[model samples]
Target chain A: MNIDMIRASAARAEGHVRRTPLLNSHFLDEIAGRRVWIKPECLQHTGSFKFRGAWSALSSLNPEARAKGVIAYSSGNHAQGVALASKMHGAPAVIIMPKDSPRLKIANTRAYGAEVVLYDRAGESREEIGAKLAEERGLTLIKPYDEPQVIAGQGTTGLEIAQQAAEAGIENADVIVCCGGGGLTSGIALALEAEAPSFRVRPAEPEGFDDAARSLAQGKIVGNARPLGSICDAIVTPQPGDLTYPIMQRLAGPGLVVSDDEALQAMAQAFNRLKLVAEPGGAVALAAALFRGDEIEGDDVIVTISGGNVDAEMFERALQTRG
Target chain B: MNIDMIRASAARAEGHVRRTPLLNSHFLDEIAGRRVWIKPECLQHTGSFKFRGAWSALSSLNPEARAKGVIAYSSGNHAQGVALASKMHGAPAVIIMPKDSPRLKIANTRAYGAEVVLYDRAGESREEIGAKLAEERGLTLIKPYDEPQVIAGQGTTGLEIAQQAAEAGIENADVIVCCGGGGLTSGIALALEAEAPSFRVRPAEPEGFDDAARSLAQGKIVGNARPLGSICDAIVTPQPGDLTYPIMQRLAGPGLVVSDDEALQAMAQAFNRLKLVAEPGGAVALAAALFRGDEIEGDDVIVTISGGNVDAEMFERALQTRG
Candidate 1:
């Protein structure tokens, strides 16, 4: 969780991943009641910021372990991230996914040349399956957000934000991020604290799965009541990771939460105003920015849209849904 | 249309308009069956490249004319562009719009503080109305694409493409643009011919409204038999503009056309892969690059997504329809 570690990871990812642009819109500025800058990681490889972490983890592995390959468990973004990362490194990968996950996610993970193992989300533990597969196949396990290397890798996004904002003459602003396992939030928090100390990362989450918000407020780890039914499937984690909480607790601000309807509205706004396709989970931070504008300080605000791997029917439903 | 005029327009538009980013994706390259670079003017001010031309035209007005205000006619994008540009210059504006234009476009145009006058697309000539209003009110007329300053302003998009592509190590590309009065196409053609001599601009149009394509092939201005009924309403011009034609006829490559369904497919693919919101007309060039891969020359191609001001229902239909 140091600046040097994050800088090293960014260097490794420079030529490997897409250097996504930082977007700005006067339309978005009016919506959030401030100068708004959007960092659309929805354009990232694998359509999410997860690929950065995946690549970091893969790069940190020993040659022997890399030769043996890796195993990862994720319902969507992380699975595709690891799959693509492994392919880039010429390593085989096994992705443990939920049987009920979106068909598009599953198909994409496989298309990236990963072996897919489907397990019932409610009846089976993906952790158990991943551990067994790793042990049996002599493969390394790449945790989605808990690993130090992965966190450092994800921190590159914060570095980009700092550089881009400075280039655009933004002195400082609150950087809001969509929170899932708190990995992205914590990573950005650490990076911004080191690179742009005046800024803070505010975690954004769905109403029912606001564990990160509760955890930050209470100054401890908190778990969700239920995570199965949230339409923001990409960010419905059970709780924040142990490794990630300390960074978030120290460097992050009060977390923000928006209802599913609000997220839908944000997605539509992103599509219409920013012309960026953001999934529900991806739109949560934007929803918080637009809905919770009063809590935000300064005239400029930066929000990162984290993913866009939405199903066709679900996106249509979101388009039809009103806040 | 000369280099100096485009450079002057770029200078005037430096701070007043957005310098849109050039977007690239390996996923899009795979779809086009070649190296693909996207210059997304969809993220431009007012959500389209029209604002560039509008700002250029408004900036070129004499101080007296600027104070006297301006009048323009457009189906949608140009109306918003003019309204915003006029507001920026403290020039009052009157926009003559068709009654059948999207409600969102009309509302946005008015929101920019312009007076709107609706007329029938079938029975009324917007040009005549605009001229009459200009004559009566002592307001300067801003023809959408026939004006030299407007074309120079639109050519900024081409200048940006050339600079960004060169930075990305692309020496030359066949640049495809969504065509409407041949303004965008001709503007880019002039810029690329001067700045990136090896490259050429290619106009993209809807299935039936391939006026620019016909004009290029015939070496004369060719009008569409009927232009009112196309899904790509933003780019359904009756014929190439008088001033814009010769530039397109000389500097543009053989033009490209796509059906409504193919444009929808391109829109869907843009959302799914590129994570950009592209209206039907804006998606035509990408559609041509995707569906007509064999017809396109070289392994590298550049496509401009001209706008993203689609209505919600239209976007929903695009996401749902499969070619």
Candidate 2:
């Protein structure tokens, strides 16, 4: 929630988090008509920036609480993040996931040493299952996005961007982020506001699931009509988090939206140019930087490829897109 | 080349060369049955570590000679590396390549502002064409390997490994590298010998093109029967280099070789576990580390993915391999 909290999170997460390099390509610069810098969080442990938040939250727990265990409800990136974090901490974890989730994700989460409990997405409520389990086991529940420590953990990425941008001689530019419920977006906005005031955060989302953009435009939280169908399944929250919306409204620039095709093209370009595997959701910010350059200003732009946990079939489709 | 020359090259290439991170995955560690650390030079500029040698050679040139121009004969990663280095230095580059080279490589080299001169690999001598062009245009011919400056440049990767190993508390381990003409292998050997003598260097090559291994076993340089056709085209050299062979004999351990299928499987594993795109040639060391672990000793092993310039078709094939 504050710079001090983020710094403390950084202190706690040191040695655990990978300091992902700031990647760039001349080809990407030409496409954006400006210098394009990429922060590849996809290379982070658990293959996403979510590890930062997960570690932050887990590390902040009191010894007794941490010893008891933790529980989370996610079938995707968050599940893997929390599972790995808990495993590293030697704490047991129970993850509530939809039975219909991708087998790869389910296997990956279990491989990280988490006990996965499956529920019917249409019939059983994940929250009810998670709450009952947590209460019975005396386990602490780790929310995916709308948590103070988690936000602080995600903010560590912004700190790295500030340092990396300085190393690249970039003083001012827009920092585009792939937004879901706004954990990463608001966290980065807060970090940059304190560390690099000249830089602004801009949320990027898939067209139909652009609740963050609409929320920012309306100066209030807005909900998407449908969030489950976007190709960018990694980032398809129905609305902005109450804790994150105000921070983003106050500290971020306007949000940007791109189509699924644009995200796929960005993924192809990332694969061909940067040699980084970026999932559809991860490529949205990069998609905006490449194809929606006119909406952004300044000579330099920094975008994050937030995650890379795509199935081979979807990655093949992304690779087949025009680069 | 000695460690001092490598240190000098690192100094000259500072700011221009990327300090690629040492990436690791728990999954990869489990498969290798040891802690596996990956130095992804594939994420380096121009999609390979060749950029290090290219930039080092270019930056070491006298102002007049550098301004005159440069030329290189390669149809793969080396071509793109030299092209981009020359362009960055504001020097003209004339790249002589085989007409049958992949269209992506040719186009990518040209996109870096180099003049691509296509020749028949079967009938004509690229050396004669390159010599003629260099003489006519006062262009310096930059050899792919066997040059002291280029070897020193590649040695910088070892210097980094030495430092990174210290940070990781790794004092003794086998440092595996993808080997072609032994430039990278010898360079790294020399660097580790001087900087971290406890660490050993091992060269990894494709099975049929395992001349480096055969050379080391025979106590002399040996040539492969055929090198023109291999899935690992990037590292399919006829034999070890004259300059590099002696260094490898003195400083490196025994070489390891992996089959094409093993390399493909390694690439697929990298995509799944590390989110890194690795070409077959680049994945050889990793392949050896994972599939050939019985031959290697130690609780920790470090492998380098030397490049990521594989074509989309090849990448798709790699993705299809069983994880």
Poorest stretch of ten by lDDT in candidate 2 chain B:
B165-174
Q: Lowest lDDT 10-mer window, candidate 1 chain B? A: B19-28
Report the number of the highest-DockQ candidate: 2
> Model 1 clash pairs?
none
Docking class of 2: high
RMSD of each: 2.5, 1.1
> For residues B42-99, what per-residue lDDT tens digits would candidate 2 score against the true structure?
9999999999889989999999999999999898888999999999999999999999
Tell me the spans in candidate 2 whose CA falls farther than 4 Å from its real position. none
Cα-based lDDT at residue A230, candidate 1: 93
Docking class for candidate 1: medium
Candidate 1, residues A161-267, lDDT tens digits: the string is 88888888887698999999988888888888887888868999999899988998999998999956898989888989999998888889799889999999989
DockQ of 1: 0.65
